[model samples]
Target: MTSSDLWDAETAERYDESSAFMFAPDVLDPAVDFLADLAGDGAALELAIGTGRVAIPLAARGVAVIGIELSQPMADQLRRKRSDIPVVVGDMASTAVPGTFSLVYLVWNGLGNLRTQSEQVACFRNAARHLAPGGRFVIELWVPGIRRFPPGQEAVPFHVGAHHVGFDTYDMTTQQGTSHHYRRHPDGSVTYGASNFRYVWPAECDLMAQLAGLELERRVADWTGEPFTTDSESHVSVWRRPEPPSRPLEAPAGA
Candidate 1:
């Protein structure tokens, strides 16, 4: 589906109800903590901060968070949070927001939404543009399942509920995956939600950061800082923006 079809207001509202609970404390808490700690007493920027899932919690922890969102509905949803956070409705690839941040993050496979390698690289550039010197950019994305799905493979399915099921299957050679999300309503109505998109591996993402002049700081399998290995299914990588060109901001004017 097109970007417009996937990210409009109506669709965004339904997102959390559809998918948020799929991940639990194990995933949510560590991810939030990682972002909060990296923020380091400075402001944070969250790209595609859908419904304030992480941003709200981080802000409640007394961190100042600004969100960059593409969908108004998504930003509106975030505004409903009991905790306060600033949000800008704009494109992650092009739109620039004011203020430099110590931490910029894209969570929950948000990087996959960029689709193309160039657009992905543009996201890194945009993050760099908004980052303070020594600021960090954190990304959470899936480890491509290509090695698991050799030629002729079609699907990898898993059961979720007694009635609901989720399947994330990919075509290895084509670089595409169809994530089938399903549910059964109390009224006995069954509905299906699916998104098909391209997938990127961790190494390519490193190159994207390098091309954007950001240096990779760390890579882990999850928010808890599990060491990334060949068996890792998802990755959390951190990148640092280089220090500014001149003397430090805190330096004396005459020096």
Candidate 2:
């Protein structure tokens, strides 16, 4: 029930360590490349940009990447790595940094971080407000509905490490799920923990963007621009902001 539990300083510090390599670019570089191409000649705004995982590389590529994070610890952590990229310590829903950006990105299902329908909508609105003319908002989120087709189906196995494994289970009604991580430590100790939440679908996300005045430009099964099909479990959605108005508005007849 607490947004701080998922985000904030303590969680931010432990996030990268616990979920290290979860968003491996080797499996995602093609998507990043596609995003980079859309990022021509302009700065980028990254939401929930924990620990600078993607922003660092993006900044290194000569792209100006600014990050907005709720956790000061995460922003501080990113600062420790590199001071080149600017990070604003605040929530993505309400935080406003001056000036517009050419590209804005939220990865790793970061949209789910809001944990509420209204909050998610606010995120879309805020993203639109920050975009420059002809800017784009790029997101990577799960496609949902794949986990439950026949009904009452739960429990999907996730292999983390050779010895460390996990199980993710979902509630058919609530659409919530728990990811349990079981790690066998070298000292004969086993670590067990769980995180739960609802999953949002790609179609719902597209609608969210459309309501925010952004248009879906492309949606790919992966970062490589692969066509999305029924078999694809996840997606990379790209949305472009409405282009500038064609001409200046004429004034009504003077009083």
Candidate 2 lDDT (Cα, 0 to 1): 0.80
TM-score of 2: 0.87
Instruction: Kindly provide the TM-score of model 1 when superposed on the true structure, using C-alpha atoms.
Output: 0.88
Which regions of candidate 2 fall more than 4 Å away from where they truly are? 1-4, 7-11, 23-25, 145-153, 248-255
Candidate 1 residue-wise lDDT, 1-255, digit = tens: 223224677777776776657447776888888988999899999998888888877888889988888888888877876436778878787777889999999998888777666777888999988999899999999887666655676776644785578788876675667778788877898888777666898888889899888999999998888899989999999999988778656877789
Candidate 1 error regions (>4 Å): 1-5, 171-174, 245-255
Best by TM-score: 1
Candidate 2, 33-144: lDDT as tens digits: 7667888889999998889888877777778888898877888889999987888988888899878999999987788667667778888999999999899999888766
Alpha-carbon deviation at 214 in model 1, angstroms: 0.8
TM-scores for the candidates = 0.88, 0.87
